[model samples]
Target: MLKIRLKKKCKKLCHAVIAGICISGSLLTTSLLAAELGYPEKEELTFGFIKLTDMAPIAIAYEKGFFEDEGLYVTIEAQANWKVLLDGVIDGRLDGAHMLAGQPIAATIGYGTKAEIITPFSMDLNGNAITVSNEIWAQMKGNIPKQADGKPVHPIKADALKPVVEKYLDAGKPFNMGMVFPVSTHNYELRYWLAAGNIHPGFYAPHKGDTSGKINAQALLSVTPPPQMPATMEAGTIYGYCVGEPWNQQAVFKGIGVPVVTDYEIWKNNPEKVFGITKAFSEKYPNTTIRLTRALIRAAKWLDENDNANRPEAVKILSQSNYVGADREVIANSMTGTFEYEKGDKRAVPDFNVFFRYNATYPYYSDAIWYLTQMRRWGQISEDKPDSWYKDVAAKVYRPDIYMAAAQSLVADKLLLKSDFADLVDEDGYREPQKHFIDNIVYDGTAPNDYINKFKIGLKAGDKL
Candidate 1:
């Protein structure tokens, strides 16, 4: 059971409910089963998140006593949007946050807000899907291939959406779409899917004060918060959007849109949100950082354990008004290993919200590099950077050292099996050349420039704004 001793140091300690657990002023738990990793320097911490199901790890960590187990008293807050969440972490108002994968990388490289944000944990994988409004879907559905039973073929690509976009363009109409943030996985994934289908989603040209991302675009894309995506599209503010779970699922339940594609289809097992904190915070509170990472890792394990036997419970926690606040049915639609596309067309997608499995929690340099490559491709980077630049920036932001420190401690403490991380042995912080992308292009993170140059619709090497 990974036994540890709680050292009694209470002079006037009283029980107080924290994330539904009563604790002794957040006492330090000493290791009686393994070597003590040292106590957290700062225990009372507040983390921020957007109300998406991908923020489940932070919620699970607190709800399942994982945070309390590490002697950390944690408060989880739902921010207004991605920008506010990142701002909170930067201004020390938030200890950390469930941030977009590109947020930390963009911050480190001075794309948007300049900061030294770092991530020791990659939260979850492949929870996002692209949804088109009912009007757009009606136009797109006719072009999509169908199965024998008359269901639309799975992994419905942007190719199906291409004709509808072209029709709008032919009529001299602006086909607008929404993504969560400028640097969000949703934005990049939407861009990737649109571009792969020969549709121009457009560029940023951020070097020339053109952050609108619609220079010569076939479909104009803009930032909308995750929770607001469906409503915005319903109002016809956008024709479609790419966003995370419950929200995409919400569109189906509300009968306003149909999710045409999931990011898993665009790029299989793609990296999603990350647990982000300032680089200075990690160095200043080394023990606290590792302990918090450990708690998160364990929470991820529990959530993905037994082929997601814990997801219904997780959906309950996430459905609470303070968390994701979506209905349990909507959250469960994706969280429970199946996703509804066209209404009544739910399909099995077991890897839709992978957490601990496939080494999903480990903060890989390759993952960071992939996000950087997307940024450069979409003109968010505004200029060419060498392969080494990508590698250096990845190393600066994605800290596997902290992740491993926490993971090894869990193994030593007998919480997780060593076999659980077999792929990490002699790891060079990069995955092998991944070929699962829907475009049929292989991405070797070791060579970012080569990958960027392979794209047809966006910026490449030496392609200046």
Candidate 2:
């Protein structure tokens, strides 16, 4: 028996050396988790966006390659507005953009162009509304208040356009309106719906040099850009505006205007737009800023996963011709939920255009302290700070520790699922106090000057301007 075939050929060479040491310890544990997801030290990125539809998670992470599956190769351009996309992400010709949750807290509190800018990600929430002109909705349709089928009932309050802006200031007329910038979240939701209808939508003495927020007035507002907001109110020049999304469904599809109200009825789930950069481009591309925020959190979880059913293929890739060129039925009337208001009144606003359900791409330091308490209740932060300076300028412009280190490296590469980020694992980055405004008040972001002293119409607590 040749010594029993040499002990079965030495037990077949000791089971092929223990199966090659368990496949080299499973490829060195996937090369140390791909060196702890740290390969992109900067990989050909461009990014910038303005043409709206909530810039759909940077155009669905550059049309779904999810920035080449985190190896990154993004480009995405389109920007003729939001101050040339926050001056092309503060002069680097945009390595990041799609901004305006008050353009990185009014460019990190210096008010306009002083940039330290940061926003790890919080793009998409209620898309925005407030259109007007069809002669100010037929003089605000006889002070709106109808329901038992007369129609105009929903959330249409700015207290019914304050007696048609006090009958155009008793016919002396300078009522104007439009807001796309001046540190826009459409200029603080059109100055919080014209100061919740008492109407003095003015101020911003900018310490007396008056950056023309029309010092002590009643609805002057300005700046227009958003695809020339319905051709600047169909050429009469801004009778009303507060944009976002196919320019308020291209002013109810060109009958020229009438959206009336929908920053989710002014505050329910607020926080609109963010993804800015330039805090030295996230400290010189820390793993290319967590691999482009893990390819915009997997393109905002594939644009709010199944419930949106990929939003008619992301409203046919934001109506093509280079993202949000509008008209794919005016961006599916509201990126496929339903919102037409006043041209055959469509309704079911399924969270309007929230690119990812409630954690809506979490960058919540109470949504940057409710946009820095609406930039200190709209004198654009000219004074009264210290609610610990609004939580240290909302933890230095809402980083959320680089959005939970790109959502915990996409839940350790299982490509997301840790209950798809259980409220971003121990999120103390505030929230929970928001009570949905349009005047019901209650904001709390750990008390921003007692929510700017409960705005009975802006500035409080030793008010200035």
Candidate 3:
């Protein structure tokens, strides 16, 4: 099969064996791989992911044979947590992995681990939501406005949880919350939602060796892995949590919690996970880097094609133990176009798990800066930085140059349409000023420092701890 596929691919490349041979239906290699046209430099690869539905691109690429179509054999493994997954990539144990959008940026900036990690693909968007325990939601539900049918109004603000937080504060008890990781989109999104409602989610002053992020917080936020969120909240360890799909929906399945607000309502169409590789890896195996990205993009396109008609199948793939490993109905609860905020209160949220729509696969510079702005806002950056610094960091980590190369190749192969990437023609990386934040504050990535100052609870310019 490899021989036949290689023969077809080689015929297209004009007999450029390009360093690999079909010896007795097996692959043998010469060092001249990817020398001229498009053969991948490194073929056998392993990728890592967390147990979340947003890891769909990697799963789809493998299951749909997109990687095999590129003449690459791939392995997909689920790491225990984000840190282990990141460490695997930082070292060479794993070629690349699905990563938090902030992970690559934070690594490049020496926040946790220092590495020149870059992402050519942004995996998906708007797949996360915040859920509170049934007790907390019971208190919050009373404050929320109801519709004509007595169902709670959506895009529920954190303001309703303010009185609950105050009740805990008034009792001299800490109001604890869980986020996936300190630099995760969940962390920033939860912080953004909390701070918007005058509930201080606290700051991280790394200069003072405080990574706890709860210095002045009214609601103390901590890390609880995505899979453990429902159990953790149910155990009364944390009152609420912000995490990606299957978990938030898991709570509803268990009748333990209710999803209060989605990240879509917090910040619409926000960039979520990224496919990250070390800079050395890209430089050492340029063609391999691009090929994997192409597979991911192809998979992303299939996932969101025809207005997510493919989602039900994708959910089946995710429900497998090798993937998300959640119950099919539970995974489909959110992945199938409707999110149940509370049990039996399913609402149409078709955009809940966006894979390729809205150019979700594109590695936009503005998206990188938005995460950077959140880091600065929450004091993870610890010091003020100029807008130029933000731009430079974003460019260093978010490599659209590589993304465009993969996208263009797909266009030339006619697997994807040129119209699909019309935005790439004269693209300047930065997006227009985003105006749909839950707080009604506009986020202009071009002027990050100015955007930071507009926030009421966050660290502003020169406002160090």
Q: What is the clash count for each candidate, in the order shown?
A: 0, 0, 0
TM-score of each: 0.94, 0.36, 0.94
lDDT at residue 315 of model 1 (Cα atoms): 94
Candidate 3 per-residue C-alpha lDDT over 1-465 given as tens digits, one digit per residue, 9 for 90 to 100: 001121233322223465565644556563332343367788778888999999999989988889876767777788989999999999998899999999999999999889999999999999999999999998999999999999998889999999999999999999999999999999999999998999999989899999999888899999998999999999999999999989999999999999999999999899999999999999999988888989999999999899889999999988988789999999999998999998999999999988887889999999999999999998899888989999999999999999998988888777899998987788788989999889999988899999999988998999899
| Overall local distance difference test of candidate 2 | 0.80
lDDT of 3: 0.90
**lDDT for each of the candidates?**
0.88, 0.80, 0.90
- lDDT value, candidate 1, whole model: 0.88
The Cα RMSD in angstroms, rounded to one decimal, for candidate 1 relative to the true structure is 4.7
Ranking 1 against 2 by lDDT, winner: 1
Q: Residue-wise lDDT of candidate 2 within 1-465, one digit each (tens)?
A: 000001111112112222221232342123344467666777677788877888888777777767765555666778777777788788897788788887887778777688899888888788888888898899888788888978888888888889988988899988888888887777888888788888988878677777878777788988888888898888877798898888988888889888888888888878788888989989988888888888888898888888888888888878887777678998888877899889898889988888677888888888787777777777877888788877888888888898888888787877888898886678889878877877788887888888788788888888887
Name the best candidate (by lDDT).
3
Superposing every Cα of model 2 onto the true structure, what RMSD results? Answer: 18.9
Off by over 4 Å in 3: 1-36
**Candidate 1 weakest ten by summed lDDT:** 1-10
Candidate 1, TM-score vs. the true structure?
A: 0.94
